[model samples]
Target: MNETTTIFGIRAVIEAIQNQKTIDKIYIQKGLSGHLFMELQQHLSGGEYNMSYVPVEKLNRLVKGNHQGVVAKISPVAFADLEEVVTASLEKDTKPLFLLLDQIDDVRNFGAIIRTAECCGVDGIVIQKKGGAPVTADTVKTSAGAIFKIPLIKVDHIKDAIYYMQASGIKVFAATEKTEDLLYSKDLNQPLALVMGNEGKGISPSVLKIVDEKAKLPILGTISSLNVSVACGAFLYEVVRQRL
Candidate 1:
């Protein structure tokens, strides 16, 4: 909450909601229960704003004054619709290139991937709405402002996004060690969606089934795998190389 843009009292936050301000997201102190809290709960359920429950220490760190436990943050970038991105990209004359992330939770890695994707001319990035890290100031700063320049699509289910891309004649490539296919062996010249999963679990099983191709980096070193962002750079630049 210390990183939040607006720190307000419970009443002030409720009033902000009532006044129809563009509240990006709201954080309420945990164990905050009462008529006012209940009223805020009902207001939040109406979907006018994004809200979450957090610890009281979080609120205290946000502000020194009596906050009464509520804070709101303004979103820096607008999210793109997954369906719209797929539809529009396929409609264009140029071949589409997408970077799909399954469950990446690291902010720095996410930002680095964005930077690489932008430099490599990826059309958009598809991230799981729930599991991905929040794109905060840290993300933007890490991306070196590439976050603003690139399009980001937050999807409820990543498999649905993959299916949408498949229906549009775009091939989906899953980057994982389990696959025998080497990255260079695949034809990256075609319209494609490259998927990279989280650090620990790799791609979720649900998303893995739909991937048209599974390719892995050629590991010649002692280490079995490269870092997620490093692998991402390799795959993205492979696309760039193929395109040229």
Candidate 2:
């Protein structure tokens, strides 16, 4: 992670939260208590945040300067409003393709997927607020700066984005090995969102139940599965091929 994107000190973190900055996570020293911390608590009361209570030693390792028992990771890219991005894409004349990630945990995988999506002309990428990888400096590096080129959206749940996509006349397809349908057989030349799941769990059963269709890439080799990023590139390029 880059120090530039991280802010320490209780007051500074509190200000960032108050300013409504897109914070990926917050680390508070365990058993920390002070007037400033109390003030920070007031701001954090009802909000949904990825918070961790760690030791002061961990906080020390996270930042060099005086942290005052709090350190926050701020997202380098501003999250786009999902409704606005979807609405704007709908107005465009070309078919809109969106990528929805279901709790993708690895930063490198997330970054590679973003790079591939941008290359394939995807309109936007949606991820959940809490479960997915936080956009760190490593992610920005691995993406080769493609993170800045696309509209990255964060939603409360992946299902919310799927529902929105379906309501907006976009078909949603979940990429999972559980399906017999092949990716090449699907007609990708239309407005649609593709759901890529986590590394281990695959797509959530509930999510699989709601998608308009489920498709998978063939695994001819001895390995039964491909890396999520590699699999994502294959799926995206197939869309590119079918559209052309």
Candidate 3:
């Protein structure tokens, strides 16, 4: 990890949170408790931030300086607002195409998805603030700079994003092997948001329940499933083909 990528010390971390810095996660020394820790906890109670308690040795390994029992990994890119993105797309008389990722924790997979989405002219990518992968140097490198080119919105929950999209007149689709609906059968030329799930678990049940449609790519090979990034690329390009 880059030194600039993390915020060390309790006061620094607390200040970063208060300043609305995009924090990926925070690491605190185990058994740590004090007035400062309590203050930090109070500030963190407002947003969806991942916090982990680890040994002091782990903190030491992350930084050479005094961490004050706390370290915060910062997001490489700032998040975009979903409403703004949608409104802008509508104002321009363009049918919006958004990608919602649920619990996509692999940095490289997330990066590759972003690259594909950008190429497909996706208006924005929606991700849960806690479960999704952090935008790090590795993600940037894997994206081939597409991370910087695309708009990303981090929501408190994936279901909330689905609800918001539906309210904004965007049809939401869940891509999963659990569904028998074929991807090509759906009309993708309308305002739409496609939900891609985690590598292992697929889309969450709550998210799948609320989506307007559920579709899957047909599997002809003996393999049980496709990699999340490859599946995402196939889905996105299908949308591109339909639009053209």
**Top lDDT: which candidate number?**
2
- Cand. 2 TM to true fold: 0.94
Question: What's the CA RMSD for each of the models?
Answer: 3.2, 1.8, 2.0
**lDDT order of candidates, top first:** 2, 3, 1
**Which lDDT tens digits does candidate 2 get at residues 1-68?**
33229999999988998899889989999999989899999999969887889999999999999999
Clashes of 3: 0
TM-score of every candidate relative to the true structure: 0.85, 0.94, 0.94
Q: Where does candidate 2 clash, by residue pair?
A: none
- Residue 135's C-alpha lDDT in candidate 1? 69
Task: Superpose all Cα atoms of candidate 2 onto the true structure and report the RMSD in Å to 1 decimal.
Answer: 1.8
* lDDT of candidate 1 over 1-244, digit per residue (tens): 2132564887887787787654656778888887887887877777634467899888888678888778876556777887787778888887899999987888889889999999998889997656666666777777888987878987767898899888889999999988888999989999999999998889998888889999999989898888899999999999899888
Ranking of all predicted structures according to TM-score, beginning with the best and ending with the worst: 2, 3, 1
| TM-score leader | 2
| lDDT of residue 156 for candidate 1 | 67
